[model samples]
Target chain A: MRNKFAEALYRLSRSDPRIHIVVADISPAGPMNEFRKEFPERFINVGVAEQSMIGICAGLALKGMLPFAYTIATFALYRPFEMVRDDLCYQNLPVTVVGIGGGVIYSTLGGTHYAQEDITIAGAIPNMSILAPCDPAEATAATEYLVGADRKGPCYLRFGKAGEPDITKDAIEPFRFGKLRYLRRGRDVAILSYGVTMGLAVKAAAALADKGKSVSVIGCPTVKPLDREGVIEVLRSHPRVVVAEENAPRGGLASEVKSVAWDIQARCALQTITLKDEFVHCYGSHEDLLAAHGLSVPAIVAAAGG
Target chain B: MSAAPRRLANDFDTTAARERCYRLRRRILDVSQHVSALHVAPAFSCMEIVDCIYHGLMRKDESGAYLDTFLMSKGHGCMTQYAILESHGTLPRSALDEYCTKDGLLGAHPDYGTPGIAASTGSLGHGLGMAVGMAVAERNAAKAKGRPVPTIYTVLSDGEVQEGSTWEAVMMASTLGVDNLVAVVDNNDFQSLGRTSETHPSFYPLVEKFQAFGWETVEVNGHDAGAVFRAVTARKGAGKPFMTVAKTVKGRGVKYMESVPIWHYRAPNPAEYKQALEILEKVQS
Candidate 1:
């Protein structure tokens, strides 16, 4: 996912001169060396100053450049929340905030490093848009879309680290930034998933299909605008609706679904297979954290019963 | 000790500008009178710093199409900028009359959509970081177009520097060697309820702090617009940025409220307003 973001940025930057990448010491560590080697001038390395990095991007955006300030998820948004809100969101600048290794991707890095609140925080911001591509292919597509996006407002791009395969059937087609894409077609239950958990959701959907329960998988890319119509469609159609994400249920995709889907009502059951409000104190790989918190495929399958 | 150049004795009319500063104070007092409450002392402390920047170095057109950019990092003192901008004809006289009202153009803090405001700031410790950003963008855009980089200026409050983000910005500015950026700290001794000096004296001797962080530093009488302008416009090597420490008095023209903390948020009563007006009106010459 990191390499996809770097490559996508490189590809888009080749055509768009306004695309500038601002990093706070992520150059030497992240997959930005390709971009750093090519456009060293455009690639600004602010050197471990997250707050300054955000401000610099807002400044660059104000100067008619589309700046993508990249770093670890928490450091990029959580640490510099005010800069993102006031300098970028409040001004409604054309700044793309790419937060790498989102959710529990940085497993061993502990609770401080994990990004469980990105989508929620991004959603709360008035002029902010959010896109969490489930896989590298969609990550590339989301990058191209946001960089070329017509809206010149603040956008937060949250995606997981590399090595995950495509979870959706159509991974490389033209994608509308704020529209929800269908991953699998079914009838009994609707699985609305965001970020890496879409992989889990797809697996759960397949498991339910084997059990004669048809589950439709909806891929949520732009969770802020939230594909509200799509959420309402699923909520109103399916007998069971399962909203899944790597974030706490309170402010993640589930909360957004509820905001637009609750009053409309589902036919039978409404459940959220999401991270518990408590911290993931136990750590191993990213998958281990997700599994321990009942987001395992079996748990999701059981939650979306026949 | 700025080592850039000093024109402390330049022909920038101290008498005339000081008189304008007095008029600016009266205008600010009048505008704040309409609003039930105002950040009077905080605004007064940085009035001349803002006035000198707008009237002295930033002689750009209203379009701001060039490299000269200014952001009020000390956004609470925006009444000073609003009043000065009106005096400069950048902002219309109507903005002052509608201040803090529901239908008003102006608010407690300066918003970017408002004329003469570069960034929305009321959140302390946010402006300098953004100023550094604007400086970098201006330089980058200029470099892309083969033009000379534009200079960036921002004014900050004494209490605002207490935030760690300010030091973070300072360190990053020095590291980047952003020569085109100039920052003026409105170092009034008082903060909200206490003397900033007594609250955190450790941050004092602020000149050494900037120099240690690799910036060209200077100290000036903040009320002296000539000194403030001279410090900002000084010619220094184009390697590191510049920060000028402008020592000032809170509630400067209002004798009774000078350095008084309550005046930071409280509006003056009718008699107090009359006395303040009398203090400023005497300087019409």
Candidate 2:
């Protein structure tokens, strides 16, 4: 998945001179080496200065360039709130902030690198579009969408480290900003999910279908300006909706779905499969963290009362 | 004429330029009082700096021949900027009255949509980076079109230096040899929390620090309009960015408010406002 994201960035860099990338001394680790090698003049390694990297990216954007600043999700969002608000969003600059190792992807790095609060923080900023791709294809699509979009605003693209399932094929429809993709159809319950958890939700829905339960799975690539209509339509038909995400339950997709549900006064059962408020006490990989957080297929199914 | 006295005469004559600065400051204070907003101290700190940059340093041209762009990184001090713009005749005094009011163009911060404001900044640590970009872009455009480079000036807060983002811009400006860019720090010594030294304790030997970072540095009393003007107009060193440390009082011109931390977030009451007005009026008179 990381390779696919990197490949898309590499391909995009060829055509756009305005597309620049700033790395936090982690380009090689973030799988952005190809981009660095290809566009050496544009790529900047600011050592360990995440805050400064964000500022530099804002500066680059001010110079009529689109900068995709990359860093671990935790440091990028937490350390540079003022820069994100003042430089990028307030000015409405076209700067794509890519957060790798989102959620529990940095599980081995323990609590320090966990990016549980990125979506929440990014969502709070007005005019900031948030994208959490389900897989590499979606990630590539997001990159292309951001590069070509006319309305240049701040965007946060959150992705994991590597080795994720390839749920999207090349034939899949081109990713549209602020639009959701309906993967499967059912009437009994709707599975609304994004990012890596979309795959988990799909697996859970498939399992429920085998047991004679109807299920629908919607992959929400864009979290901000969320597909309210799609979510409402799904909720209007299905009595129960399960929102699953790799991030914390608070301020994640689940809360957004619930907010939509509440606005419409829908009485359907809404379940969320997400991380609890507490940090993961154990050390492991992304899968282990998800499992511990009850974000696995079986756990999601159990949460949905299947 | 004696050399020292002649220099002093030239320097003191710049005070005549303070009429515009005073008007700007008065407008800013009036707007803040009307809206009940608390930014008068920060606003006053940058009034002379902004006035000197726009009126003294920049050359007026629709073609943008001289200093093409100016940005206020310390956005909370927008009143100073508003005053400068009004004095420059780009923005009218009527617009200054609408500051911080609902549906008004002037908010507590500098905005790009506001005429003459290059970038909008309220959140600290953003303006300098944008200024650096503007300078780089101007240089690139000049190179592409085979024209002389235009200067870019960014006004920043002394407290903003505590933010790592400012240093990143500094590093980039130095490494890229952005001699066209000039960053002026309004060294008022006070941030949101009392004095900066008591809180962060980072001693900024600004000239030495920036010199080490490959920038030509100058330290001046920010309140001295002539010194600020001179510092800004000084020739750029070869292949190096420029930084000016403008030593200033936080709540300048107001007797009770000068160097006081309370003014950082306090809007003067009716009595205090009257007192402030009287002090400023005395200076003007």
Candidate 3:
């Protein structure tokens, strides 16, 4: 997913001279090296200063330049949160904050690198658009939409690490901001997932289907400006719904679904497959951590009444 | 207020500038009269510095578009910028009258979207980094178009410099060689409820710190518009970022309130307000 983001950004920069990449002490490698080689003047490495990185992005936006601020999800959103609120969102600038390795993708790197609370923080800021693309294809499409002309105001693009296969199976819709896309159709129950967890959601839906339980798989790429009506419609139609995510339960997909469900008094049994409130202190691979935290396909399937 | 910004003469006019500063000080006091709490002292400390920038330093082109940008990073001292913006004709007089009111556009902090405000700042340690960003963008854009890079100016408070982010910005600015960027620290020696020197003695010798950080650094009397102007303008094309530590009185122009920490966020009582006005009137005489 990170590689797809870099490639998509590289492709976009070919036509848009206004696109500038601002990173904080992250070394240039792979596609980034090519981007640096092609646009030496445009790539700014602020040298491990996250706060300054955010401020500079706002400054660039003020000068009519579109800046993509990239870093680990934790640093991108947590380190300079005030700058995100004051400099970018407050000004409603067109600065795209690209937070790589969203969720516990950096599983072995410990809690400091984990981005369990990015959605809660980023979603609360006004004028902030969030996109958590599930796979390489969606990641590419999301990057293009965020940095494209008619630029959206102050967006947070949350992506996972590389090598996730396409979950959409070439049945992708033209990427729409703030709208939910469905990958499977059923009636008895539905599983709505976003970001890297969409694969697990697809697996869970298939597992539930095999057990003779009709289940729908929903892909939520646009996290903020959540599909409120879509959420309500799904709640009203299904007897049970499961909102799955890699983030904390407090303000992730489940929180949005719960809030929307409450607004119209929808009476569906809503369940969540999310990270525990505590940190994943154990060291392991990303998949191991996900399984340990009850986000494995079988766990999700069990939660979906398989 | 004039409908268009009144550009000051090219030559430095100390006496005229002094007179303008006094009038602006008086105007700022008048605007803050009805408000219950404000950083009048902080604003007064940077009044001359901000006055010099908007009136004497910030540039405009033949099309009347401003060539340079200024961010009030020391957001609490925003009254100074607001008053100057009014005089610069960027804002109407009515806006000043409605300051901090329910229907007013103005707040304790400077918010972006107000005419002439490039960034919303009041949260300390935010403005300078944004200024550095603006400078980088200006330089990049200029290099792209083969034009001269426009300067970016931001004012910081003495106490605000204590924030780690401020140093983060300081380190990044010089490292990037943001020569088009200029910063003026309103060194009034006071924090919210204490003197910065007493609260944090190590913060002293700021000039040497900035110098060591790879910047062209200087210290000046912040209240002297001419000195502030000379020190700041001297850094143009200096090939490095510049930092001016302008020593100032916290509650300048109000004799009894000057250097008084309690005056940091207070509206003067009737007697104090009268005495403050009398002090400025005496300076006018």
Candidate 4:
């Protein structure tokens, strides 16, 4: 799925002469091979330096060019948080930050590799718009919006690893940034998920339906702007809301929904199926980690029952 | 009001530039008194480097538009840049007088939207990478127009080199062979708390480190306006980016603050300002 998103980015770069891809040394892997092979002049490899990558992208934006900087989730944003805030966000430069492997996707690499709280840092910054697409199609749509000339400021696009099937259907309005995709409409229970957790949320909704529990799942790709109206509308109608994500609950979608729910005077039970506040010392496959951290489909079903 | 942009002739006016720098220091002192604090020692150390770049190195085209780009990568020393640009008549005097004040267009660091500032800096290690990006952009723009690549100048401080991003930019600049880029290091050897030499003894031999990374390196007396100007100008079309390590004192003109690290941030009071002005006045530029 990430490969499709990267391919879309490469294809977009081909059409727009103003578009450029700058990396902190992720070439010869993923879709970078194609980008570097065809557009060597436009593809810059900064050699594992995330801070320089952001600053360089800012510089390119200042020169009337658009730059997409790519790197792993943890190394990409956390290492250069200050640069992202000061250089890209402060200047409000049109640099698209393509962060791959969000929310424990880097399983088996230990805690250092996990990028759980990327949204928290990115969402907190001023003049920054954030998106975490559920699958490749949504990722491509988000990428197109970011590279578009209409984007007013810096954007962070977080992607879960490849091979997650599309949790969204075509009948839903085509992917638009800052708009939520309503996967199902139901009363009594509203389950909101961002990024890869959408698949689990959908599966959980189906299980709860079999048990005669009415459930609706909403996939929120753009977490920062958050489609405030859409969220408020959902809260107004629903009696129970459960926020699900494969990230820390403190600053992830759960916290954001609660912040919105508190002032709206909505009467709903709030439950979050996310990682605990502590670091995960255990190492395993992606599924094993998710299950151990209580982010599996069963966990979603249980949380939805609330 | 912002001054009208003008393409002043760059014939290497040494005497006039030297005199301007001297007076610029005094002017910075005057402005520093009004503000709660300014980076006086940092500004003093890199005063001539900023002057040399703005006066001797920058190339402005006929339309009074600047063709070249410069970034104060060591942004804490922006007072030096503001002082020099103000002296060159490109910046309004009111901007300098109200610097770092509530209504000042100027602040402790260089901001992009302000008049004549190329990039917002003062965040350590951002300027060099930005300059590299600017150089690459200039190359692409030149290729589009079938013209020469415009030079991009960035002034870095010795302490700023400690940031890993600085070395990352150096690696990329050499790999790309960005000959249009030139970096001037205001090597006064002081960090925020103390001398970099005493705090981190292993960080020396900057010339060799930059050369090892494939930069055309040079060393000079940073205080000498003529020497700083010559070292930068000599690197034109050198087939690689150039770096000048200007060995200097932390406080170049003042009596008590020379080589002192506390003055890196601490501004002079009225009495100290008077004594420093007397010492600065006696220097023969």
- Most accurate candidate by lDDT: 3
Report the C-alpha lDDT of model 4 over B1-285, residue by residue, as the tens digit.
111123333456777867887888898889878876889989988888888888777777999777888899998998998887786677899998888778878888999888788899888989988888888887777776787678888999998899998998898888878888889999998887787888998998889999999999999988777887767765644468889999988878886988887787887888998898888842333
Docking class for candidate 4 = medium
Query: What's the residue-level lDDT of B144 in candidate 3?
Result: 77
Model 1 lDDT per residue over B1-285, tens place: 012223444646656777778888888788767877988888888877877776667644457543378888989888888888898677888888988888878898999888778889999999888888777777767777786677788998988888988888899888877887889998888887688678777878899999999999999999888877776766574688998999898888788878988988888887888888876532211
Task: Give a tens-digit lDDT track for model 1, residues A1-306.
Answer: 668878888877888878888888865444467667877767888788788888888877776788899888999999899999999999999888888888888888899988877787887899998989888878888888777757658999997876878665464334567787777667898888878888888888878888889778888888877777777777878888887888876877887777666577555587787788888788898889988777778888877874
**Against the unseen true structure, what C-alpha lDDT does each candidate score?**
0.80, 0.77, 0.84, 0.82
**Chain A alone, TM-score for each of the models?**
0.95, 0.94, 0.96, 0.95
RMSD (Cα, Å) of model 4: 3.7
Order the numbered candidates by DockQ, best leading.
3, 4, 1, 2
Model 3 spans with C-alpha error above 4 angstroms: B1-10, B281-285
lDDT, candidate 4, at B262 = 74
Give candidate 2 regions above 4 Å deviation. Answer: A28-31, A170-174, A187-189, A209-215, A265-269, A303-306, B1-19, B22-41, B59-67, B137-149, B190-204, B250-285
Score candidate 4 by lDDT. 0.82
Top candidate by TM-score: 3
- Candidate 1 residue B35 C-alpha distance from true site, Å: 2.3
Worst 10 residues of 1 chain B by lDDT: B1-10
Q: Which whole-number lDDT from 0 to 100 does residue A39 have in model 3?
A: 92
Query: What's the i-RMS for candidate 4 in angstroms?
Result: 0.8
The sequence of per-residue lDDT tens digits that candidate 4 reaches over residues A1-306 is 678777888888787766778887775466767888888888888877888898888888888888988888887799998889899998888888888887788888889988877888788899998889888788888888887766778988888777888766542556788888787888978888888878888888889899888887888988878898888888887888888877786776788788888889777787777887778778887778888888888887887773
Clashing pairs in 4: none
